[model samples]
Structures are given as structure tokens and as C-alpha cells.
Target: MSTVDNPWELTRAIAPRRYVNRMIAEADGVIRSNSYPSKYPVNGNPPTTPWAMDLTSLDGRFWFAAFDLDAKTPEAFEQASEDLGVLVRILRDTGLPHVVCRSSPTGGFHVWVPLAGIDKAVMVQLADAARAVLPTLDHGMLCNDRTGAVRPPGAPHARGGASTVMGGADDVDVLRTPTVTAGDLLRVTAAFRELRPTVDPADSSPTGPVDARHRAHRSLPAWGEAHMATVAGGRDPSRTGYLCLLAAAVSGWTLADVEHAAKTAPGMEHYRTRNRPTGGRERRTAAEAAARLERQWAKAQERAVLYRYAPEERAQRDLTELTGIVDVVDAMLLAFTASPGRWTRTEADLHDSTVLTYLAWLSLRTGSRDVAAALRSVAIATGIPSSTVDRSLRRLHEAGWISRRRQADGPNAAIWRLSGRFSTPGEHVGPLHDVTARPPAELFDVRAALLEVLEDRITAGRHDVFTRAGLGPTARRTYESLTTTENAVHTVAERAGLPRGRTRAALASLRRYALVVVSAAGWRRRRLDYRTQAAKKLGGKVHGALQRRELQYRDERDLWAWWQDHLIRKGGRRGRDRVPTTQAVLFRAEDERGGPEAYPLYPCSSDGRADHQAAMRFVRGGLLQDLRDLELAA
Candidate 1:
């Protein structure tokens, strides 16, 4: 077969040195060999070792930008097949034909359009065009850097999987090597360049009016061509007719136009012959066959008007309004930090403040009380694990801070809305106005917020009780639950969302680490009450603070550290000195607008550490206690 006729064969002819099969060491000295690209072509001799992850680019070779659809597991592989169909549809709709290879049944695919040493500018433009169409593809494998490495198709994966060609094979019974002549590849990419702007760059949220009609016009031909291929490949006459008719209706094509397009669609005639060939004697002319197709198109037009081609309008909020939303969230978080009880019953329940901040930002950014985002998007933005986002979302939901609405129509995204309790009356969605009402202190995920605080302290050595204890998640949770008051083992277990056995095991581990004191001398003999022996033993006012709930200090030393970090201001004759008194510092900070007071509260205790109890009491009974009191004082 001509190299131009086979994608794999063409690739090999152009860059024969790119392919290599090399030994890879697995567990127990087990060795495997698979095809991987060398750093550069070696004139048919490959390197002895596999390519390293850091070796991202190569030189002196004709390269293509690759979309690597890879699944790490079998389930994902199956899902990838569906994703592949979406990608093919994207290509069809955009009217760009490119070669695609199923690198393995385990769900690995490489879709590529060769760059003919195209200048950097053209490549960049092509990359952007590719990105524009990428959203239509589910989980499309693309890299930010267009010049990155692409694995050759001839070799198996190092993990021991075979590669097979996909798309436009004549026989379903046998796998054929994929091929696209160099000239064809370039022609398709050039066509992509022309169609790139018909639809705006893949910005789902456009700030201004988009040329919807123009985009729709450009998309029609690709849609028809793609459906034509689908019909040919499926060899279903009815579907071919249905799709062709629907395309005509949607595109507003004349019956004559649709007939002409379908007849010349490369494989249309072949499919027509195989599915419904006209016999001899009464030999039907091409005109008669075209009429039959036109009839089908006319039938499909009846239902096509119902399909929507226009983009929906999205609500846009001014940048200042967006900033105001963030400020409100900050204020809410600051208030929560002052008193964890304002949100949760226990301080330890505040797991990661950063995640909470991310959630708040997302909600505000979307200009809605509710946010609908994929967990993957959250994880990427927050730089945390998707699992962590899942856990945090669950905690927030349980705490009554936000409610989740699972997507019913498409994609795996979930909708999250801030609690009505936290929202101001008649407040418009988005960040247009500040929520003036006193922020709610009675509900939220306190632990999620505190995790961010703990992370800071951990880095500063201001607190290490939890980390030093080396407790598992269950143990850590159990220990936190035991901090404020002793509870029955079952109660603690239920609160921590663990099984009885698991909770018991966690409590025992905490006990072993001296983090929790578990007592078994209760009425039922198996009944247990727990307390944080570690915090109570810290001595001085810190110990008293923990017992009386007068302060939210985690450690005795943390109080002084918190004071040094926040309360002390630097404006003395010497240019840097303590502000003298906590009351005075607070007054100065508040008086100077946009000072530390304007920032999120990082309150210190009387002796100088985090004291959520005192902070809450101070805010309630001290500063800004009531408008009536202010009037009386005035």
C-alpha cells in the first residue's frame, strides 16, 4: 500500500527514527519492552532505555500535535470509547479530518494532524483552533505546549498493551493500519485554519455578542460530512437518510443542494450500493437515487426546527462587583475564624479554609448563589485532590453551608448553592452588591476552614499536636471530637462518620499516641468517654482556656505566636514596636481603614494566641454590640 494511504505508514516514512521498543523495569526485576518515541530520530536505531517524562520535545523531525486519550484503568477505557465518538463528532462538525489511532483497547488513543514544518506562528494558530473545537470532545487529551512528544503507533505501551488503527477501516473483522498522506494531513489543517474563527475561540462565557448565525453557517457542511461518514461506516440506509435529511433541515439546505452534497460525499455511493443498489433492466439513473435521498431529507426537515443553534445569554457581573463578593466571603471567613462555633460545634471540624475560599470564589465568580462546577475543575483551581474536594463538599453540605444539586442533563458537574440563611434578603445573584446583613455564625463547615489555618501554623511550628500525633484521618477526627467534651464511643463514632469498629480502632490509636484519654469505666463497661489529654496538660492559662472554652488556643505557645503575628504594630520612634495594648491596637487597626481590621481577623487571646471563644464574646458583647448601645453612647 502507498505510504499516503496509511497514516501509520506515512508517519514511519517521515520520522522512522522516532519509534523505539526498549526494556522497562517493573516490580521484582520483571522487564517489559514497548514502543515509545526517542528524544530524536536515531536513524532506525533506538535508545536502550525508554523515554523519561522530563524529555518532552524533539528536534529535526516532522511532528504533529497529538491528542493522547489515555485511561489508567479498564473502566476509564470503556468511557474513553464514548469520548472518542464525541471527538470524532467534533472533527466532523469542524470539517477537519485527521488520523486517529486506538493505541490500545485499554483506552489509549492518539489523534494527530501533521505539521509540515509549519512556521511557529501557524502552529500556534492551529493549536488555538484545535482548542476551540476541543470542548466538544469529552476529556480530550491535549497539552498546553504544542511541541511536546507524541508516542508512535507501531509500538505497544510499556505497560503491555497493543496499538490498533481506528476510524475509516473498510473491514470490521480485521484491524487496518491508519494512514493519511502528508498532503491530505496538511490540507485538513489548512482547512481547520480557515474554519477556526467561524465560532469564537472556545470561550463558553463570552462577554459580548457572538456571531451565532455565521458560526452555524460554517458548521453545516462539516456536520453533513461527518454524518455521511457515520452512515457509510454503519452501513445503515435508514440512518443515512435520516441524518442527511436532518442536516438539510437544520442547515436550511435546498433539497437539490442536499442531494448533490450526499452524492459526492466520497463513500455515499459505496454505501448506497451496498445498502440499496438499483438492479439492471429498469436501471435507476443517479437522478432517481438522488430523488430518493431528497425525499428522506424532506421527511427529516419536519423535526429539525426544534433543535437550537443559538448560544444562551449568560449573566455578566462587573469586575468591581466580583471583588465585592470576594470581600464578603473574606468577611464571613474572618468571622468564622474568630469563633469556630459560629459555623460548627467544634473547632476541629474546620478542615481546610482554602477549599472553602475556593468554593466561595467560584460561587461569586459565577454571579450566583448557586455554583455548578465539575470536581475536576475545583481540584485544579484549588491544587487539591478531587477526593479532598468531595469530602469537603460533603462536610459543607452536612454543616448546612451549601447544598449540592447533581447535574441531571449532561456532564458530571454538580450545582452548589450557598445556604439561604447566609444570603441577604432579595439579594441578586453574582457580586454586584455587598451582603450588609450580619453574616451568619450559626452554620458552616468549621473544620474545612481551619485546615488552612493549621497548614500555616504547621509551617511556622506554632502548632504540631495533630501532626506530631501521626493520627490517621479517623483518629484525627476522633481526637478533635474528644477535645471539647467527653462523649460515648458510639456518639463519637457517629459524629466522625465512621463505623463503630473503625471509630473504636481510631480512638485506641489516639489513646496510644496520648492525644485522647479514653475511659472504659462507665455504666455499660464498654461505654467510653474521651478528652484531649495533650491540650489539658499544656499548663497555665492555655489549659484553663481549653477547659472553660474561654479561648480557642491549640497550644500554650501558639497564643504568644499569634500575638506576635497580628497584634503588634510597627510604628514607634524606633520605627518598629508593639502597639502597647490589645485594645489600643484594635482601635488603631479599625481606625486606619484597610488596615489589619479590614483584613480577615487573626485574633489573639489576652496572653496572645488564637482564642475563638473570647473573639466571639468580644464581638458580641464588646465592639459593635448593638446599634441601641451606640446611640446611647453618642
Candidate 2:
């Protein structure tokens, strides 16, 4: 005596399995499904004997609006029957056909309204109309989204409860109402649709007077785009549920609005949550779900408002006030190359150097030695990828050249303050790489002199040797590190903010290109000790240009006699002559033209002997490697 002639449907009604003859325990709880399985168990394993029917998903698209009643004891069954009598009277008034069946032996009834050959939406509308008439019914079940759970007649339930038909049809018609046609139900459904609350899915933004500029044209926020994508993905309805709830909370939408939007969304009906159990309890009602969603939404909003908006964006200082700072910074950077010592070529990578240059410029512009730099914003400014910039900045921090202070719960960029020992001056001074200690004040003086000379060289149009070297970003930065001092690989990488492997690779590339030479200093604990020196050919083009300029000055007697004499000076055991130093040869004309006081290219170092030795090695050892390439004989 089944509605359809499918034995599988009757078997499904008897089984405890949820979907496709398999019981499923999701976040919502245990569900018995009657949907067809894509593949059945094989290799001697049989499918579940009986599966619970998913009434809403059965063929013919007829919707099942079930009303579950609990009586507990035999005596309580009387009240349940009385309640069903009241419900039947209400349904009879609407002329809708229905059934009354027993769910468990202990006494509970499932009064189901099966809409014949109608769309599920229409069925839900019919259920809503029925629910409206019997508003006081405790266990009212509305199958709006086709997600509710319904056990088949004669199925097994918890607590030794066996389901059976109580009354309906000719076989069982105790308290049944007059059966109505499917067309009559459809007509009633069409009428219910008019009464349903409607909300635009796209119009969930917060309610407020739109700004004049935004009034003419409106667009969703970034978060809204993310929310819609999450909903459409349908991977997890729980996440979507929270998102929708939060959206509603922020936009001041009611539960009805959320439901309407969800109902209208294509494919959203497949997300069944209503009949699922949470925490071993039945799924929440529409109002309960809304309230829970609202609480979470409120907490999130509070956290964001308190922590996110408290701090300002970037702190902008007036440019006018930073005039002196800019000029001083510009002078230092420009003169850095001209001043002697191991300071000219920092050997910093292009990205790192570029980042530093920007930081320097910002310090000048912002009138603060400490600058706030965002990796993304910095990448955009420097034309480097954000990932690369991030690596470079990490390297910079490790090198102790810069100090970083991270912002706490703010949109402000990480705060970066130039190293006082290098930028300003204090106890920590002298050569950044020197093992020997020197007075902080004295070291600062030496560094200042070098920077001033570098500035002069820039003004005089000296070529930047780093650019002419044609090295990769990391190699160039590593090369600069090598030029500074002989340090272990880890030390160099740490100083450069590069990975150890990257630093090693960069060294190999530099050696391959003959930019620098690495010599084994000694072996310590079986590890080969290494020391690197810039190849004399490293500054090949600049060396050639300087040589040519020097020759022109020497040939022109119009140049000052002392200058000519100085250029022609000799020093050896037997008074043998040697070429002038690189700086002397390069800067003589500029110095002569613009006086030593104004163009201080070579400031006297406190330790002249040491400076002289460094200069001699720089020209004769480092700079002399490419004498042939410089075309000195030509």
C-alpha cells in the first residue's frame, strides 16, 4: 500500500541510512537520506538494507510539510491527538489534503502535507499558509529550502520507537481531512507568494543617507564581494550561514530578509541545515539562528572598530619643516662614494639598496629618522615585487643597519628607525665591520667625511660604479657585503638580510663574473675560511673614464703647475714613479676648479697611515686588476 510502486522507496523508509543508503553525521547531526547513490558497495558488500527517505527530494518534486508531535506517555497521547484534531480542522478549512502517521511506538505523530506534482517552492508556500493558520502548533515544520528530515512510515527511530501509519486513506482515516487537488494547492501557493517578505540580494548594505558622491552610483564593499563568493561556492553552508548573519547584522537586515535572499539565490536550496542537529539538539528555529548570528556579528564588529580604526594611516609631516633634513641627507648620500674608506660601495643588493634609498628619502621628506614602511607600498614605490621587498627588508633588519618596530593593531606601516650608530651617532660607531674599537665621535667624523665627499662626487657627475657592474640584485648586494669586510657566510647573509643559500649563490655569481675574488684565509673546525676582495676590474668603466680624464689634465699645461707636479709625483726604493691614487686622479680637476674648502673630496683621516694603505690597496690591488681592460698601454 505505497503511493509509488518502487520497492526501493519502501525499503528506504525502513532503513536507518541517511543519504543514498548511507547514514551521515554532519555538523547538523544524524541524517537519513533516500537519494540515489552514485555507486553501490560491491565485492561481497551489500548496500544498507533500509534507508530513510528524503521526502523533499523524492521523485515528482512533491514537497513534504511534516508536523512532529511529542506525547511521551500513553496519557499524553490524548493531548497530541487533540492538537492534531485542531490542526486537521485548520487544514480542512483551507481545503488542503494531508496525512496523520505515528512516528514512534511511545506516541508522536507526523502530520504531513504532500503537495502533488508541484515545485518545492510552492509546497513551502502551502506549508507556510498552513503554519499561519495553526500558529500555536509547537512542532510546526516548514520545508522552505527542502532541507528538513523526514523518516519514512514503518521506519525505526531512537528509544525503541517503531514508526507506523496512524490514520489516513481508506486503510487508516480516523482524523483525516478531505483530500484536495494539486491545482487547488498551487492556487493557494500563488496567493502565499504575494504575502511572503521580499528582499533584494544586492541591497544588503548598511542603511544610511548615501554620500552625495556615492548617491549617483553605488557599489558593494570588498567584504561584500568576498561574502557573495563564499555563498556561491557552497563548499560549507555553516560558513555561509555565519557570513549571511554578519552581513544582516551589519546592514540591519531581519531574519526574514536573510531567508528571502537565501531563497532567491540559485543552488542555495541544496544547503540543508534546518533538519540537522547541533550539540545533540535539534536545529535552531529561524529566530534562534538569527539571534546567534547577530551576537557573533556584534562581537566581530566591536573588535574591528576598537583595534582597527584607533590608529591613523601614515603619519604625514609638513615638507617645509624637513628642508634641512632633506638637504643633509642628500649631501650624505651624494658624497658617500667620493669619501674614502670602505664605505663608498655598500654592496647592498639593488632591491635592498632601492628600499634603503626610499627609506632615506622618506626620512628626509617626513622629517623623522624613524620611518614607517609598508612592504607592499614600498614594493610599488621601488618597482620591486612585494615578496622580494619583504626579503630585502628582513635582510636589512638583520644587518643592524636599520631597526624595526611593528605596529600593534593598527593600519600604520611598520616603524623603521635608522641605526643611530650609522645614521646619527653615539657609543656605537667606527667601521660597521671593523673588529677593532675606535672612539664613536672619531668614527662618526670619518663616516661624515666620506658621505660629504660622496655627495660632491654625485654633484660632479661621477658614474655610479654599482650600476655599471651589471650584477643581479642579490649578487650586487652580496658583492657590496664582501667589499665591506671579510665575514663568514652566515654573517654576510645576516648583514645583508639574505638567506644563507642566496648569499652563497650571489657570491658564486660575482666570482663567475670576476667582480670579486674570494681567497681562503684559513681553515677552522674543517670549514674553509674565506675572505673576499673587489676585483680591480669591478669598476672597469669608471676606472677607464677616470684614467682618460687624468691624461687630459696632464697633457694640458694650462692646469695648475702644483696639480701637474702632484700628478707626476714618484715614490719607491730607488725613487721609481707610480700613478696617483684613484681619488686623487679622479677628483684633482674638480678640487682645483672648486677649492678644497668647498669641494672636500678627500678629507684627511685621523689615521693617515691607515687611510693611505687602504687607498693604495684600493687602487693598486682592487682597481689594478683590470689595467689591461682600462687600455692604459693604448
* TM-scores for every predicted model: 0.32, 0.23
Across 1-634, the per-residue lDDT of candidate 1 in tens digits comes to: 0012433343345442444324456676554433333343334444434332211124433344456655434323433443454445445544444566666545456665544443333343334444433222221223333334544444444545544555452221111222434444444444433322221112212111222222222245555545444423232233344554566667778866665655545324321432211111122366556555654554455334222211222254444443344445655555443444433343334344435555664554344555665554554443334566677778877877767765523323677765544434364677755543322210111221232222222221112223322332344444544422345777665444446676687677656545544444110111122122443454343333312321232222233332333444422211112222233332322223133323223455668567765545544443422322333334
Top lDDT prediction, candidate number: 2
Clashes of each: 19, 21
The digit string of per-residue lDDT tens for model 2 on 426-500 reads 375677676444332222222233332222222112222233333435554554444212356776665445667
Candidate 2 structure lDDT: 0.42
**CA lDDT, every prediction?**
0.41, 0.42
RMSD of each: 24.4, 31.2
Candidate 1, residue 546: how far the Cα is off, in Å: 29
Task: Name the TM-score of candidate 1.
Answer: 0.32
